[model samples]
Target: MSAALVWFRRDLRDHDHAALYHALKAHTQVYCAFVFDRAILDALPSRRDRRVEFIHASLIELDAALRARGGGLIVRHADAREAIPPLALELGASAVYANHDYEPAALARDDAVRGALGAAGLAFHTFKDQVIFEKSEVLTGAGKPFSVFTPYRNAWRKALTPFHLKAYPVERYAAHLAAPPAASIPSLAELGFAPSNLAELKLPCGMRGARQLFDDFRQRIADYGRARDFPAVKGVSYLSIHLRFGTISIRELARFAQEQANEGAEVWLNELIWRDFYQQVLWYRPDVVTQSFRSEYDAVQWEEGEAAERLFAAWCEARTGYPIVDAAMRQLNQTGWMHNRLRMVVASFLTKDLGIHWLRGERYFADTLNDYDLAANNGGWQWAASTGCDAQPWFRIFNPVTQSQRFDAQGRFIRRYLPELADLPDKLIHEPWLMSAIDQSAYRCTLGRDYPKPIVDHAAARERTLARFKAVRPTGD
Candidate 1:
């Protein structure tokens, strides 16, 4: 009987899975596997990374789900390029199946795996699972990949059909899910990692967790448009980590949003489209992984040496003295997640306000965020830095104080993360440094000692950032 091996990567779910569906349909017997690829893991600076913990937890659920369906995930801790070929050979499989990964390194690894599998006379099949549309699927009238989001979003909506939102019914061929010998999944200690505060954070893991968050979000989705901007309010869908790890299918989420057809639903659906747009950007311009998308902006100089390092360190540790930015950083440090509005606010503050490079901020986010994806993270940092295609204009800089007063208007979100400012009035919470010595003593928090003083003067930084961008910006830009 012909056999197939299904390789699970970011997409961890059992139902509505594209590769598993195709593999089970074409082969009489099929086995599933997941690799804790060392190539990716070894380079991580922290073994206690929450993302690793989250993935490990999700995999346990994935394994149990597959076991119920007469199959089990063959978990491994080797380089995927080396592990997959031998596993396929051992299982006597004629083919290997997986979902697409658009990151440059991932693409390179896939190419190597394909070559190895081809040499062994086995087929390596991949399908689009994580995204609704991939690569150049949704392009312009001239067949060029879209660099701007709005036009791309319009074209994406125009091209959407029921076919695109359809889920792959993997259960239909579950009879072909061949049972494998019981393989032990390595513990966190065995994998050279330590425990994290994931459980304490109460982040749901695996398919079940994703569903729980989704169900809650659906109820408040009508208010999502207005409430999402307010960090203290639970207005946003906390499904990003699930989406990043593929515990939930994009098709499922997009379909629900499309069906809702409310104002909030439309706005939420646009965010998903933005995700697809960023993925396509990465596919078309792989150089964006290391360099700016708009090449000319590469010449823009960023602050460096001792002063910049101090500023960056302050930013990372949530001691930047800007309440909103500090609270956002603290939230990420503590929970491995941050509010979407705060993400923009912090990124803008990092690049435009601090006169620091966007790549620095991007790297920090990549290292810190639990839901970090290369495409979206890179796109966001570039947009804030004004160095990407169709990015925010260079002249526009975010005022961190204004953002704090606007979003965390009552400073409730700020006070949640910055307890030292809890006693300060809402009017002064956004700018504690402006408070008089008597007021600071009354509040029992002193700037530069208890919390921190504003790192940079916003107006001065704004002028400097404008001049810095103008140095590299093309004529008439």
Candidate 2:
């Protein structure tokens, strides 16, 4: 009986998984495994990281799911490159299969693992599971990679076919799952990581958790475009972490959106496309991980040291004094997620209003956000700071006040996150400082004491931002 191994990476689910499907098809006895991946985990800042807890919870669920099918996930506590090939050799598997991971470090790790497997006369196969369109699949007519989103999105939509959205019926092939009944998944502490405070975080964790969130979002998806920007409303699908880890299939979500594209289904569908778009951007241009996509925008000088530290501390602690920005930051600090619109508002506030570096904000998000993916986070940061390919026009800065008024009109979002501002009248919630001193006293809040004064004057900052943008912009235009 020929045996094979499926090395699970970001794609954690058993259903509709490309690598699992391929492995089952090619081999009669299939061993499944997941590595705790110390190479990645050790580098993370916190042991109590929510993402780690989320993955640990998901893995527990996955092991049970596999056990029901007469198999179980052989969870490990080593670096993948070191662990996978050795396991394949011990099991005498002909090949190891996994889904693609486009991050540079992941790619390097995979290459090393492949080499080790090759030395042991084992083949390594990988399939695309995390994204709909990857690498250069949706290039422009000129055969170059797309920098602009709309054209790329259109091309992506056009390229979609039945085959792309088809789910791999893993259940039909379940009999082949290796019956390693004696193999048991280790407890989280055995992996040298402590249990996190994530149970209190209220985030959905596994396949079942992902589905529950999806079902709720499906009902509200039609209003996603209208409601996603408003933080107080439960308008956006909170499936980002699920999608990031592959607890849910991209095909399933894309198919759901594609089928309902008419009555504003396109709005939700567009977000899915944005996910793919950023992935492809990262795949083709890995340099975007650190440097600017458009090189010239890198010339814009950034504030540094104590000044930046203070500004960043203010931004992170929700003390930026721009009510919307503060509220959004509070949401992120408390919940590990931020609404997309506020992501834009706060990012613009940091880079343009405060003249801070995009990378600083990007790093902060990377550290804080549970749903953070390298591509999406980087793409968002670059777009806000006007340093990415087809990024927002440098001159078109977002005014924080107008943005707040437009998106969170009733101060519902602000009040929810900024409880200090909760008692203020709706008229004063967006800009608490504008209220008279008597009103401020009545509201029981004072700028610079109870809250913060605006870090930078919007008008003065906007002029400075405009001048800075013009300084580095293409001379002819």
Candidate 3:
């Protein structure tokens, strides 16, 4: 081909990028472009979106990197499906390349783009870049998609090879990069978004940011296994947003994990594998986006009507009366992120204790989380609700107090987010309702006064949840 266009979607980096590498290697003149799709941006619930701000900052870096290497990014704010083909035609490119996006909506968008490209006598090529293994790359002995995580993890590990971990060597074909026509990258305001707390949260953006986070985490990976569960501790890598945006290469991180022999690295590697596992699940069963993975569990009725609305609002607004749950929700509300362990705790409390539908909580997370990945979020919510493949057993519901007492033993995380309960003794912090009037007054915290009472009795809620699931439980294996 004389010329080719590379469309940047989730894969934003210049180096080790599959589509970019292919475009540069295959053609004499290569152009790169990213469209801030209106179809997506116009539907966002808020103007001050951290995700958009992060992307804007990242694009500025990406444009700089590309410019330094004899290429530049072409930016546009339009419907991508309506823009990509015409942009390719206007550039007189023979082909358009992009990394695969497995989300159903993305797949549909890509399909539309492909049809348009084909009609214009142009080729559209996509490669697996975001994930290590995709589609049927890893499967069960019966040639079926592995629904359970353990066996899938084992299979994913066994299937690993050096080739899968190797970079695409994009710099090798830097000669093919064509300089862009004069045009500057768009500002966040120009793109119809306001700046969010992403910078105040100290989250670096783009390739440099990803590198910063990975380097810091490399030093702490050895301790991840033991310390990751405590929300008060900085035990986990904050590279999730980086990974979500493709600012870092999956191959690079997985290779680093594979080289490390420590238990913490092993656990972290397992998390990466889980990421791949969820991606594959999303690919094979896009229906999981709307329905339960195990359909039988769908029969279990969730809380409804005004009472359900009140409970859900309490959960979202961080006044659930459970210190840990409220604290977790508060963290999510204030920061665009939540601790991994707290995600499970709060999700369990919403679905099990309050009996609200998982989708309600799932949609809330989708809106708020900076790393709001559909596959992982849906998989997690379903797991919490005991409605997913290899999910937590319905009867084995989480007791909010016990989880709080264990995970936040000193109530450090709780106090950080719920300052009203800051003076409560650690023993009583997890359950302030247990404090007597004198103790509550002495602590400067009064139940239903300083803080709301527990929204639902854990024991009672647990029994009700068990009964709900039991009604739909398939008899005998």
For all predicted structures, in order, the TM-scores are 0.99, 0.97, 0.99
Q: What tens digits encode model 2's per-residue C-alpha lDDT throughout 155-247?
A: 998999989999999998899998664666676677666776677777889999999999988888888877777777888898999999999
Query: What does candidate 1's lDDT look like per residue over 1-477, in tens digits?
Result: 999999999999999999999999999999999999999899898999999999999999999999999998899999999999999999999999999999999999999999999999999999999899999899899999998999999999999999999999999999899887668899999999999999899999999999999999999999989898999999999999999999999999999999996899999999999899999999999999889999999898999999999999999999999999999999999999999989889999999888889998999889999999999999998998899977999999989999988888899999999999999999899989889999999999988899999989999999999999888889888
Residues 361-459, candidate 3: write the lDDT tens digits: 999999999989999999999999999977998888888899999999999999999999999998999989989989988999978888999888999
Q: Is candidate 1 or candidate 2 better by lDDT?
A: 1
For each candidate, what is the lDDT? 0.94, 0.89, 0.93
Candidate achieving higher lDDT, 2 or 3: 3
Q: Which stretches of candidate 2 lie over 4 Å from their true place?
A: none
Select the stronger candidate by TM-score from 1 and 2: 1
Sort the predicted structures by lDDT, highest score first: 1, 3, 2
> What shift in Å separates residue 301 of candidate 2 from its native position after superposition?
0.9
